[model samples]
Target: MQRFVHGFLLLPRCSLLALGGALDALDAANATLGHAQHSSLCLSLDGRPVRCSTGTKVQVDHGLADAPELQSLFILADLPLPDAARDGHARQLHPWLQERARYGMLLGGIGSGAAVLAQAGLLDGHRATLAWAQVPQLGDSHPAVLWSSRVYEIDRQRLSCGAGTASLDLLIAWLGRLHGERLAQALVGHFGLDRLRGADERQPSPVQARIGTGGAKLAEAVALMEANLGEPLPTEEIARLAGVSRRQLERLFKQHLDALPSRYYAELRLMRARRLLQQTGQSILQIGLACGFASGSHFSSAYRSRFGHTPREARSQRALAWRDEPDQPPSADSGRTESPP
Candidate 1:
């Protein structure tokens, strides 16, 4: 049986779900193959243990500088992309990563790990995908890279996914390429996965779940509203599209969501604005305009009413949170897991 070593470069605050899911898939593949066809090593920059976003501490086998040769290197980085960029962690690793790429080792990134590859200029002109929440941030930061909303993407030797169970899908597809479709199918069955999602499949919108059980008309109206966030449609137009009267649409929202149609729509737009505030570096005015607010004052007033804080305050709090968060261990009583270096 052929053997290969896969290196997982664990960044601080990486997503435990992404790391575990990918490793679990590989474990299943090894069992299905009836041999150790794939081996994985966890590594950090300085051979230190790293804490995941869920507070699980992952012990590393080696640091990048001390690691042996690798057939493939997958970066497990599922934290906020903006934090990764601001912390300069990827910049420190960029030179070594570029060297490894030159040596022909296949590179893959899970979640915001794609940001590191982009920082190293490896993803420039390459089509890649990342978590939808990070799209605006990373897309704005790396304009040269083609960012898609797909669950996963593979361009030549580069592989990337938006994290979560998507990591498993990417791994399963890679297993198929490495072994065969039969073995991949066996692993999928072993893992009890319903079916493998294709790499090009777009991530499901959260609004779908919100309006799914309301009614077809309500769901269609909500979808239309989501698609037109920048320029909100009139209630009458939305009702017309859903084949319902405006009064009926308002009744549906009140019945299903316990809110009026206008209120629900405003909440949706405000939620979007909040995401942009937390995730992207766009100006407050720009975000307000993008969310269909008529003016900055109007946006601030509505935002304060919904969230109990002005937009600037929200942004400031995020900045302070990011600044105050240290990569070091939390207190033992804090319930956050961390391992000593």
Candidate 2:
């Protein structure tokens, strides 16, 4: 079986792939392993040559719908996602992605492409990051998708990395997962990356971590929750961890996050559950427990309330659309499975 990496040019005749960053990383992967363990294909919206954000035109051999099974698919969209949205591509592509979870594949949004994923409904209930300037827009439009100011985030099967050199690290981190550090090093060496960093590496510039009093508290609480998702702490204990009394925690949430502590916590848990549902083939009971829900029924009820869809509905949506063929692993898998370092 031949494993592959796929790049989908989501922009019409406009934005180009971060040719140097993305291609260089992939080239390193090929050089380290001799020939290429991973093959790449460029699927354009219309199967035509499109210009890069820098005005370089590249030819794409197939349309997204006609592309073969890939281990990963990178949505390379320059500019704001609204540009893609205006072109009617967002509507067409959203349905395709909604089904990606079923096939056990992953989807990646590079640079402004995060907006495309958001527009497609893939980022809802997922912790996603985007270019800083677009963060407000994303937050305003998709209140359900948690907005992170980080350079990149991989919440389950969906990976969204910000623009520029960060993309190099994103792809390199992904390559490292499949071929091991040795191969990733060789690829980085081949590409002249003097400082080869791991996938979990952050950008050179620091992004603001604080949102508001509520946002800050929520963030701290989320960190605590993630660290203890396996063995959940009591609400009062979590309040203590956040340096507030239980009543204070509730008040802060109502003021900032617009929900009570337990309600917000349940939403966070359901968000995590959604990731597990789409990324792993874990059983529902197992996923519920892992995400800190008391039982499957509890998890399902909360998931349905927040997403307005059942956990099974969300899982089946992904399963039906992005399934792998006997010939190959689906492309989206590359962005989904790399463990955080």
Candidate 3:
């Protein structure tokens, strides 16, 4: 008789979408493997309800302050967490993570949850993966932790994935370990996944796999642009980095992306600026400077043009969403069960 037991600690602003998706997959897996009896629970700080990134409410079953013993625990976090959320819940959950790691219990950090784990001193000297979008900040913040952009990775006891659907991959890998590949596959089938990702497999990033029309060079160029969102490059410089002439770069974007390189770059920069504006407490000027705008006026003009609203408007909406949303549940560690060809 084999049994699988796992628990997840939800952080403030955790991705409820991913959490719910993984939970749905887990339910299907349990049904397929006849393991509805599997042990699982969702925990939070003081066992309170949590709000997802998108303002959904989820009920949790326990609190780290209440439950101290679990075979495994996953941390679910979304980046740019309010200091209140991180310090209030995630920091409170840190001591428990340390205790679990010391005992060699499997620890999982989904998306930027790795940040919380790092704060706990659990991810020190361990290679980990985080949402690629947060890579820049994560690197600057957690210099002690080795970070990668892979879909999911497990270095010894620490496990993590980027964001979004890759969580399913993490859950699948956990099931595989507990019940063997047979049950893992059963779970994958239940979720309509065709295969499982190896530890080395990368979940596709938009910058890497150009869906509509770009080649490697263009993709690489896009990646560079994304990585340097806070400090955009000149069009000629981007062309140089991509090993294409300025004219050639313009032609490529026109032909494939259907947008000029300069316009696309500005859009990407503005998009990031908007995220910072909404997700962080940074001032509008700070956001503008960080996103490569020369001045607040420039950022405001570009933002209004592209989004049809001021940056302040977006921030206000996000704040409203955050304040109005309900609580959320926890997360689990499952890997991509389907192999990527």
Segments of candidate 2 deviating more than 4 angstroms: 12-17, 82-89, 197-341
Ranking by lDDT: 1, 3, 2
Task: Give one digit per residue, the lDDT tens place, for model 2 in 1-341.
Answer: 46576665546433443545776777667766677766678776555677777777778877666666666777877553433323343444666666664576678888777777777777889877766555544564577998776767777788877777767777777767766877767766666778665434433322114343325665676566645655677889998998878898787667666777777666666666776676556787877887777877887887888899988888888877655523333233222221111
Task: Give the clashing pairs for model 1.
Answer: none
RMSD of each: 5.9, 13.2, 8.4
Best by lDDT: 1
Evaluated with TM-score, which candidate comes out highest?
A: 1
What lDDT tens digits, residue by residue, belong to model 1 across residues 203-303? 65565566664487887887778667778899999999999999999998887779887787898889889988987789999899988999999999999
State every prediction's TM-score relative to the real structure. Answer: 0.77, 0.55, 0.68
As a whole number from 0 to 100, the lDDT of residue 152 in candidate 2 is: 71
Off by over 4 Å in 1: 1-3, 81-90, 102-104, 119-121, 209-228, 233-252, 260-262, 316-341
Q: lDDT of each model, Cα atoms only?
A: 0.81, 0.66, 0.75
Residue 11, model 3: lDDT of 75
Q: After superposition, how far is residue 86 of candidate 3 from its true place, in Å?
A: 8.9
Residue-wise C-alpha lDDT for candidate 3, range 154-183, written one tens digit per residue: 788888886678888888886688668887
Per-residue lDDT value at 163 in model 2:
75
